[model samples]
Target: MAEIQEKADSGKGGKKRAKKMSVHLDMTPMVDLAFLLLTFFMLTTTFSKPQTMEINMPVKPDSEEDQSPLKASNAFTIILGDDDKVYYYYGLVEDKPELNTTDYSANGIRKVLISPRIKSNDKMVVLIKPMDVSRYKNVVDILDEMKITDTKKYALVDINDADKELVASKTGG
Candidate 1:
């Protein structure tokens, strides 16, 4: 509780007593000032911007001009198939390149991409070939994995007919 007190000495040669008065402290102005400051800060405060991946889109060619081919000898290909299955090959897709199966697990595709042989190869490139039956999330997951693994030299390639036939033979589809 707020207390106001006044003391006086009414003895011989004593002065007059101090008048007792109630202290009128209007908290309304202080509360209004606090609310104004809060509102001003809330209105002027900037929110953190959302982060996004920066992808440089290729400009369409005027005509079908031939471009330089990718080096298959120093390439690692990943083919996304139905049911979230991932097939990969170390080098070029030969007449019957051995297709290894893996998942999107922490120890699955991550292990392969982070291997010493692949990681140490500065000239190695990753080719991502997503099939028609594959989900859109499959592409996003692989792209995220590439970013997570720090694989910069990568490209999104179309699944060729040979690769389709090979996948069909393996998947029995």
Candidate 2:
């Protein structure tokens, strides 16, 4: 609501001038309406739900001896290192594991995961070993890559001494 008032001043002489008008705006109603709209929008609008990646881990057995050994032929290892570098090898690390370096791009790790041999082989297993220097996002990116490639069998394992040695030698770290 707004109100206008005119002020009349009596001069020293008898000369009369135009009265000055002042306007006062009452903003209580406007403020109340604004707050009401704010509350209504806050209550009605929905916030984005937190997104999550699903990872299915194997159940632990009662005895360590009960676990079966993973076949080297069916295993594919991916090592995550610093500087967004990825190293992969087929089967186990032998005298000289044929390690190949790649990035997180589609033409890199994705291509290797979807290769004819790896994709066609139903028993193919992906072992992801993230080094201490690797970022958490790298692990998430690799997991997303696994999902994108439709890789069914994958495990997150600790980087072993052999893997460390191979990475050091290949990366010249």
lDDT of each: 0.86, 0.92
| lDDT, candidate 1, 1-173, per-residue tens | 34565544446576666665665555787889999999999999999999878766566677766555566668899999999999998888773678889999999899999999899999899999999999999999999999999997888999998888878888887
Measured against the true structure, the TM-scores of the candidates, in listed sequence, are: 0.67, 0.84
Candidate 2 on 43-140: residue-level lDDT in tens? 99999999998777788999989987878888899999999999999998764668899999999999999999899889898999999999999999
Residue 97, model 2, lDDT: 69
What's the CA error at residue 22 for candidate 1, in Å?
Answer: 32
Error of 2 at 112 (Å): 0.4
- Give the CA lDDT, 0 to 100, for residue 164 in model 2: 94
Give the TM-score comparing model 2 with the true structure, all chains together: 0.84
